[model samples]
Target: MKAITIKQPWATLIALGEKQFETRSWQTKHRGPIAIHAGKSTDKDACNDSWIKSTLAEHGIKSYKELPTGVVLATAELVDCYKVETTVGHVSVLSNVKVVEGLEVAFGDYTEGRYAWELTNVQVLAKPLEAKGQLSLWEWNGDSK
Candidate 1:
């Protein structure tokens, strides 16, 4: 399956549904079932913020420092890719996300981090492979099976 490698805490945030948008600097034309791969780089400063902590707390989420990086944490189908609208009356929509089974992921690159990357044979952890919840699948990739 195709997967996009994302930097640390953001990936965690996305997995936990703390942050919705993946915040891409550029736009993507591809949309489909993609693996949420967490990278080794983490935002250390943001990790200690009260807002972040509080938000997670409200959702009853605990510190995820124990979770490994550089692997796919969860899978979601990308419905569409669009630019962030900062204007009024505009809501960033991931559209129709379908959360895949949650899995414990490792840290490291299967291939150099690049756009539109595909992966196979990566280790999908047996534990924590339960469905935490559902998410929007913005873009359809025809891999729902």
Candidate 2:
């Protein structure tokens, strides 16, 4: 399966169903089922945020140390990729969106020119399979059955 390596907390947040979009500085044309790989690096600063911390706590994750890394955490459909047009005040209005605010905005960087990969039908693995991460989209050799 095709996989994308994402830094921790963000990867876990996506797997936990709290985050719906994965923002990137780049964009892709591929649209299909994609594996969500949690990279070895964790964004400690992000993990320390009160909102992120509380959200992880809600999922029984006590701290950043407890987040899984070097594993494929979940699978989701790469439904859409929208370019962030510009920010109207604090909220971003996607080129394809009229206005986007709230948690969706909080979960990602809505800076103009970035891309938001819309993920849906997320299926988190009960036992995450170990896998080394790579930059951008790469192929995962593991059986996702």
Candidate 3:
């Protein structure tokens, strides 16, 4: 299976199905189910943000304490990847999707050059599988159960 290493809260948010898109600097042609790996490093600054805290709380995530790291926490379908020319256009992409305003900000960088990796059918694992992650999308042999 293909997998991508994402930083803390973002990975957690993706696993919880709260984040519909994973923003990236590059684009990918691959599509289908991919493992959502929480890299070992946490975005400490994002964790300290009040909006992040509140959004996590809304999802029953009280603190970053329980967030998994260096593991594949879930699998989501990589349906599409695109880049919008304007910030307004970027934000509008989620208008049809139900996403909290704060979460949209937390999960993506709506800059002109960034690519949004659209995901669907997110399935959080019953138990996180430990693995070392690589940059960009890499292959994972572990079962996504």
lDDT of each: 0.45, 0.89, 0.81
25-125: candidate 1 lDDT, tens digit per residue? 45566666666766656665555666665655665655657445655576666655433322212222222332211111111111112112222223333
Report the poorest 10 consecutive residues by lDDT, candidate 3.
Answer: 92-101
Local error of candidate 3 at residue 57 (angstroms): 1.4
Over 1-145, each residue of candidate 2 has an lDDT whose tens digit, in order, gives 8999999899999999998889999999989999999999999999998888999999999989999889999999998888999876558887666567777788788899998898999999989999988998999977633
Q: Which candidate, 2 or 3, would have the higher TM-score against the true structure?
A: 2
TM-score of 3: 0.86
Q: Candidate 3, which segments miss by more than 4 Å at Cα?
A: 89-102, 143-145
- Give the winner by lDDT: 1 or 2: 2
lDDT of 3 by residue, 13-118 (tens): 8887878889888889999989999999988778878877877898887878867898999999999887644555324343234332345755678676667788
TM-score of each model, in listed order? 0.54, 0.93, 0.86
- Please tell me which model should have the higher TM-score, number 1 or number 2: 2
Q: Against the true structure, whose TM-score is highest?
A: 2
lDDT of 2 at 40: 93
Name the top lDDT candidate: 2
The Cα error of candidate 3 at residue 1, in Å, is: 0.6
The total of clashing pairs for model 2 equals 0
Which ranges of candidate 1 are over 4 A from the true structure? 58-64, 87-145
